[model samples]
Target: MAFLDIDALVGLFPGQGGYRKGALASFWDEGDPVLRGVLAEIDEVALRVLGTDIGSQIFGPAAAIPEGPELFQLAVYTVSVATYELLRVREVEFGLLVGHSMGEFAALVAGGALTVAQGAEMLCHRIAATAGTSGGMLSLSCDVRRVEQILDLAAEPHVVVAVVNGRSQVVVSGPEQGLARIGAVADALGLPAVRLPAPAPFHNDLMSGVRTEVVKRLGRVRCAPTRTPVYSPILGRCYRGDDDLVDILGMHLVTPVRFDTTITRLHEAGARVFMEVGAGRTLTGLVKAAHPQVVILPALTEPAAVDTEDTDEPVDVPSPQPSTTDEEVMAQLRAIYAAALDYPEDVLTADAHLEAELGVDSVKRIQLLGRVGRHFGLEPSAVNGIADHETLGDIAGQVIASLEASGGR
Candidate 1:
């Protein structure tokens, strides 16, 4: 099982429904004492940076935390580090380490390139350096060439394709007006588009100022050669021990994420079991889409039964629940979305436009769909038409239809 570090930011919150809150809790409950000590150290750093207990915010009752690019990035970094520690305590091993977007920092820590505290500190400085930049990103359900053609047609050169996630998914980032132009072009091209909830256009030339500052700050942090191989999609290859971590990571801010190519390379390198180490199964789904034959698992949400035979310790994770009625499914989904998006349950009615009215972005949309797929025991591809649904009611109806078709209810 070649463990793949799923980016924490892929999922909005760990404990929220549609997410495996129990799985996250079990890690802390069943982990070694050293795991707890590591978490305590991380908590102290988090308190200093955030002025609040990040552990409490994530592990406590489901609630909305401060929403912004910097804070969101920090929360992702915290959960990722904790998840990595839990995996280490569990004695899970990986042949290679890869992270999506900000997940690279967690990969570095897990691969022995940086201490948890050093990684956390670097993330804090990263947030500070990139703060107040003006721009946004949009996810287009089209290939890179199509997006580039659309941009050319619209005469919008500012918007650059920030991430090539898959054959059908590409993320573009630039000035707000440029993003708007891309949206219009996508609409005119009849391509599905969703605006990401980003405060600035990352992985694009818009972040040049951020890059310079981050590079200078990153040089001050001590980094060692990675213990495990770390594959960098931003650099389009594996990171040699002698590579300049500071320059590569700094340039990562303005370079496009070639995840599609990265996954292919991993497969070529003989990685069969891809395990996502963080909050959600976003990367899992993407990996499945790109390489369907590979075994994919979510480290934060895997059932204990699957691993009991490998370990001497007993595992006590919950089993899958019995199928529920359509109404029950709808209600559960509503609650999940509400908790995940931090919106009132009442607002997630049949008529509410998920994107327009509720401001749900592509990342959150993927999280919601991933949760819905798990809750109902559906395949990852089962939630394909999620974007076509305009309202919660529309989504509920789709889920019901899928359930009925699958004989799940």
Candidate 2:
């Protein structure tokens, strides 16, 4: 049972529920206004815990949301102890299964029900379950019947009602024209409707006939059960260990997902630990928000501790006090540089260009500047001449000088 690296999972599933890194950062930074604040906090936690490892970089800060390393950690913690042993030894188990969506493939592969290559194929085929299907996902604070009325008004040639989330939120998908018509009706009714940040509309009548396509793909793949339990979102119950997965998997393409009920049933069935494996806190956060008593954790946040060579007792350096006014500013500059680089003061040079000398990239530069601004807790743009600074030390000097000029302690 070898432990699965979170980054490997990212490489495995590209452009699925979430974009890779480039899209991830933007999604957090600017993509969706609603996700910005939440993403920022998530990013902070990620950087602090994961450091600058391959998993974090590959997943990035934003796109990582759906299937981020954090979710993988959660799965590791909550899954069966035997599964943990397999992960420890890089072995596979076939008895473990997943709840729904592409996440199922990940769980199946991890459980050894499917080979890694088979999992990859299944995921690719699963994409067909929604590929090229034009429809929009709208979140509503109502149930399916009410949502259908909104869809009825839209009455476009291509509209399809999609997922039903929780008691209040329902997502609709169909042709954009139909969706637009629906939106107008929703507006007239004064009901809030927002489009989802997804590429394809899913789980509607539009996919009802797509089973042939899915069955063909599913047949080509070999499957087995380690007798792992699969909780069906559609049935609001668990499929018997020996239930026919092939048929159920095909039907899933067109079924309405009862995620809320399924989760509730899991708890009722005594599933104390709910680990949302793969990526994103989407499920875990929802689970935690819905059921705060449950323990929710993600794998990405379990960052490997910093590696050090010496085991000797560490020595603490005395705090150095400046002997003069200029020296005080210099000391502050050193502090600023250390904080900006997330490194030691000895590494930063006053004249060294931050980008060229310290090798800071665009993301790192923005993060550093953001940190500096927060540390000063003022309008960073107010520091007029500091933009021309070459290094962290220079920026620090300008910041301190401005603070002093403004009578800031």
Candidate 3:
């Protein structure tokens, strides 16, 4: 049976300053029932946490800037949850989800692992627990290996790589002195690095104390199984039904985020379309750099009015069938894999072993299968045996089998 065009939706939650100026005003003026409902929920939580209406703080005349670390983190969380609700009301469906740093709580809520109320409470507690910790984060335009090398050379005990965002982008977190040392090293190498506007050194050993407290609190809080699969880059895998949510979330505080690997895994799992669900284009930009061929849509862009009515719904885009002949299918598969892997078409052939001959890594193999799945309109289950295919010819055979199973001509 032919399935409805299934596009993988990835929800992105921004870390800081996600809601730009006038964000509240836009939500109020639009008067979307979904937005209103989300606002009310957030306001209720804000009142309990901040002892004031967050709506007024954000939308009132002479709006107060989110100054304190705790308040700023709360603002980011609240706005992200509201944005997620707005998307849900519009019938946006997510196949897989991920978040950056503080955005993980938002991802859990969106994925149904936690309710909005639970998420708000957890986030507020996290902020409160980690508030006085010293140190900060710095973004570096260098690979993880190089960053580690620099850290090793510097011998700075406090600083550590906090995130592996992409092939060339990483974030390091530590005290001011450690950061200055790292910056000097980057300068010597002529690499660009900038200090992130974070109030504390998050996703590092510095937050171990906070992680323990949060985990204990999470144990007392009830959590439901996830509806949408939420991948934790920190844990380097998707949250399974049997896994301990509290332990996972607790460890997430001290683990470095392997975002690059997360994207690869999602693509391998047949996710082709990624959408940034929250207030900025940060995650969108990272995804683009990681996978240029996949479709990316941003739910919000700064300085532009959010018009929920005009957003295009994801529909299955048709793929061309070159021919049904075995030889033709093999040729087409080679071409697609070559293009996706940035290798010349001649480098791949029916006899070439995907790994030994073509240098196809595990992540690249997953990407290859996803592309094939989309091209021939195969069901996700149809591609489940992709790991068994060792050579180009072997993959071609599986594709032919899937085509026949799907009643494709």
Clashes of each: 2, 31, 0
Ten residues in a row with the worst lDDT in model 3?
304-313
For each candidate, what TM-score against the reference? 0.71, 0.50, 0.69
lDDT of 2 at 386: 48
On residues 1-409, what C-alpha lDDT tens digit does candidate 3 reach at each position? 1121347577777564344435545666667676677667767876776565566655547555455656766666777777778778778788777877778888889989888888887776676667677888877667899999999988998999988878777889999899989877776665556555577888888889989988766566678889987777777766777777677777777888877887777767666687776654556666766777878786645342231211112323335463487877777787777656555678677776554234343334444565677788776556644444768888889888878776785
Candidate 1: worst-modelled 10 consecutive residues by lDDT: 304-313
Highest-scoring model, lDDT: 3
lDDT at residue 301 of model 1 (Cα atoms): 58
Candidate 2 lDDT by residue in tens digits, 33-134 = 433332343334334433322224323343232233233322222122212232334432222234444455444544546554454444445554445656
lDDT of 3: 0.69
RMSD of each: 10.0, 15.8, 18.2
The lDDT for every candidate, in the order shown, is 0.66, 0.46, 0.69
Better of 1 and 2 by lDDT: 1
Q: Candidate 2, after superposition: displacement of residue 350 in Å?
A: 30
Q: Give lDDT for model 1.
A: 0.66
Error of 3 at 168 (Å): 2.1
Comparing 2 and 3 on TM-score, the stronger one: 3
The most accurate candidate by TM-score is 1
